[model samples]
Target chain A: MGKDGEVDFSIIGLENEIEQIQSNIDDLENGKGGSIAIIAEQFAGKTTLINKVCSMNKNRVEMISLSSVVKDEKKLQEIEEQKQIKIIDNCHFLYRHKIGGFDIIERFLKTVTSPENKQYITTWNIHSWNFLENTHEISKYFPVQIKLQGLTQEQARQLILSEYEEGEIQFIEDPTENKEKMINFVIDNTIFLNKEIGIPHLKINYRQIKSKLSRKKIILTPEENIFENIYSISKGNPGISKAIWEQSLVYPQIKPGDIKEPCQDMELDNDESFILSILVSMQNASRSDIIEIAGDEIDIERALQVLSKKNIISSEREHYTIKPEILKCATNFLRRSRLV
Target chain B: MTMVGEESGSLSGMPSIDTGTLLSVISLLIIAYVVTRVISFLLTAFSEKVGKYRIKIKMLLPILKFSIYGYTVYYIMAKLLEVSAQELILFGGLLGAAIGFGLKDLFADLIGGIIIVFEKPYQIGDKIRVGDQYGEVNDIGIRATTITTPDDNYVSIPNYVIFTQSVSSANIGNSEMMVVTDIFLEHGSDMKIARKLLKEAVVTSRFVYMSEKHPITILTKDFPFYIRLRAKAYTRDLRYEFNFESDVSSRAWKELKKKGIKPPGANLIDSSSMPDQRDR
Candidate 1:
């Protein structure tokens, strides 16, 4: 986690996105442009970037981080009067997902587009940004839109290891000669004398094949393979990669095979899917907010229970959020369903 | 022309077929069938896995099936039976005449299926209407195109209908399809709020898919009895067309009623015809 005073490069591998944002800020400081919207997936470091921007600009910008839905539309109007630039995080909370949920967002859009001397910087979930882009052409209002990309293997390594001292952690290798074999001995049941028998079935591991093929380009040392596997599973997402790394770590030693893939499922009803989409857009939605948005047609408990059973989301103190490791899979599933 | 100088083993200008050749033909046909079934299963599984490329991947099914069967037939005639070019043409002509006389409808349907595959009128997963049947096209078979009606009824319309009747596809080959939702309000209702609520209802619907290319549009027109508010938006998937419309309409109506935007009273407009042109 980055501090408010000094921002770290926790959002590694997003130099391009940071550069684009910095260029936009430069243009704003010169009085040459409009507002900017930082669009990214949850836990992709939107908040860290905002802090970095605030600390870099010192007194020129004021930050407003919305922890929950904004019921008062007028509260947004009363920004720091001395600051010319305002950075609002979780801008997706500006509106709800119900019938009359768009009033506050509409007012905000109008205020931003009405030729005020001030410029605003906002951070939004990619899915929420997409919904607004389609409905209100939100992109037109924010002249600069920067989407944060995922971290690379090197960047993920740096981000994950930034906290630990050199040689404090041990990178252990696999005991077997064949670490990432493309072929594996998978178990299967075969009928023997009218009874089922378990036997070792020779199965081809396609993922191992891909990993092996990818090794030809960048071969890592004994310890680097752990980060590579974590990167492969997490897809270089900083939060997910770090989470997987910590879970796989045993005190000072960590093994490559310790990093396993997340569990999979094939069920999501319409209501469950809608709830997941809402949670993704909001990043942190209370149970009541979910029920209110889903309305009467949905059995909110069943949906929430199903999501919990699948380990796709976790709730604490009535607020639900997607698991960091499951974020990519959940997003992909939602995208396939067109819910996000 | 003359049985290839009598060395190709022809009987009455027809290719000679022995027991071995017949077995080979059967084996070839079995292999082709297995190949097509496996390919179909894999492609369908993959298409389900990736929704964005569902149509593009499924569109390859008919073509792949045809290629496999076409090659199987060609191999059986040209290599297994060792039929000459001239003899093959003569046999094809005879078969064509027999089909023309006895199975005209079947042949027409076959040709229509071929046209559907190549001409790109509509493919699998498209929302189409043929004659009076409207639904999401589930499968495009050799003889007919099967669609699951909004009522969830699987209706198989003959492919030949593409030639005889006017066929319309709401979404040509894309997953996002435009759905028209209408909301009627009293003459003295809050028009601006109704429009705003309708737009919000559409944009906020979980089933809706919006982008710069597929925009949500709301239009209003004053009718004799009341003003009709129509919302034109694209559903994420054509299969969710009705659900999207219902989602938008119900939510918009709920908000409209709360805001005192009363629906036009019963019997104010003609029950039989409410100017469907009020759509669009």
Candidate 2:
């Protein structure tokens, strides 16, 4: 699709969404300036799509990432003064985790929607957008709303595989016979022992079992179509599919089955779960931001440790984010617990 | 007459009863009671496990209990006593007369329960205030509705009371509930700052439900001594109504105090200057 290890942005799906945005931009160029909201779930390619749209009309559009300018009213005003089509990313940050959190969003909306010769395109997290719509009637202000759908199987495969070179890695598929052998070995090895000498003994060496399992590697070729498995597992989310693909790779070879299905049964206490729910709701947050949202009573560091041990989230520098594949699971967990 | 005697006397077109049939009827009643209790316990446990969808799980309890009890009554009459539909109708008339004379209240309660299950004025887990008792409905029984009050007291109000008293349900069936909190301040307090601070408290509260349909509103009323500020908002869940109110009120008070707003002062009476009896 492009040079090796580079994602061919053009071939990625969402042509319809891009076309609609382009038409809106065209309308803006003809003096019909209005607001449009690009709404999607976390890592559903909202940023990538906006980047592509802006790149296509680099000279005509001004890109403003909201997360960078959310607290800077002067920067916002400066961007507002420029008489050109503007694209804003992460507009949901305007809704903070505190009281009067919607004030910034309200002010931004007022400034953008004032009868003027300007058009603005904004992106938002689906949860935040829903909350704003429910509380502030945000949809009325954004007359044009574009929701990005999950990638199709073909799209997911193309997007994910585009990041890897041809013949660079080998795929591994577990054969039915080998799977049975592993299952039998695990079951036979799991034995409950009773001590007669008045001494407690740990019979199961978990590390040994883990090492044995890790050592048993089987490799296959690319013809196995394991991309379909990744796509299905990620529910055709391009970001998630790509993350799973990357995580599954072990240098020159990869095992599709080795990738854990993102924290489905991890037992989290109430505090840990609450912190996780906040993280999922906010998509990404800093430690201080989480502490503020969770309140002083909660031992946030402990909760973070628990979540990290459970592999529910990952931290990069100052920001912590849930893996794309786990985002849907975490959201469902929050919904089931009625935290949302 | 005894049930067994009545079965034997059916040939002579007269009712009679015997010890064996009486024992059978008693055993059947006990079995029905025990079975219903067991089913109820299992359902309750299941509903607790499925917390968020507990309401949907609870909807099955009334239906199941009705079916089980109805079948048990039928089984006792038709299978145990070996009575025909015609005999049931005749017996039902006599029983109706007895109920009309002595069990009117109990019968009304049962009928009221059936209506409640069908009409759904309120359901299990709904936050309802019946007369002076306000609480979440814990159980809906054939004779009474049990409510677990905020203070954790289980009150069993008769089902028939629904016919006479008004029941206020905070949440009809949805999880989200509107919570109203009131804050009082000195009459001369700044309205702008008070309103802004109270609104911020609500939107920032962990329990508050922020949605367009349930936008937080702070309305003020001028009283002689103080200004009554009522914050109308929604909580994410009905269970957090009190917590949400407490959070908003405490936060608002803190902010108001930080902004130099004070509550109404006590009224002072000048007793020293009052006319003495000797002077009069």
Estimated TM-score per prediction? 0.86, 0.80
- For candidate 2, write residues A44-73 as lDDT tens digits: 888988998888888888887755325556
Specify the CAPRI tier of model 2.
Answer: acceptable
What's model 2's overall lDDT? 0.75
Per-residue error for B42 in candidate 2, Å, reads 3.8
Q: Which stretch of 10 consecutive residues in model 2 chain A shows the poorest summed lDDT?
A: A182-191
Q: Which parts of model 1 have CA positions greater than 4 angstroms off?
A: A1-32, A56-58, A74-80, A114-117, A177-207, A215-219, A263-267, B1-38, B79-93, B276-279
TM-score for chain B of each model, two decimals: 0.90, 0.83
| Best candidate, lDDT | 1
Supply the DockQ value of model 1. 0.66
- Can you give the lDDT of residue A238 in candidate 2? 79
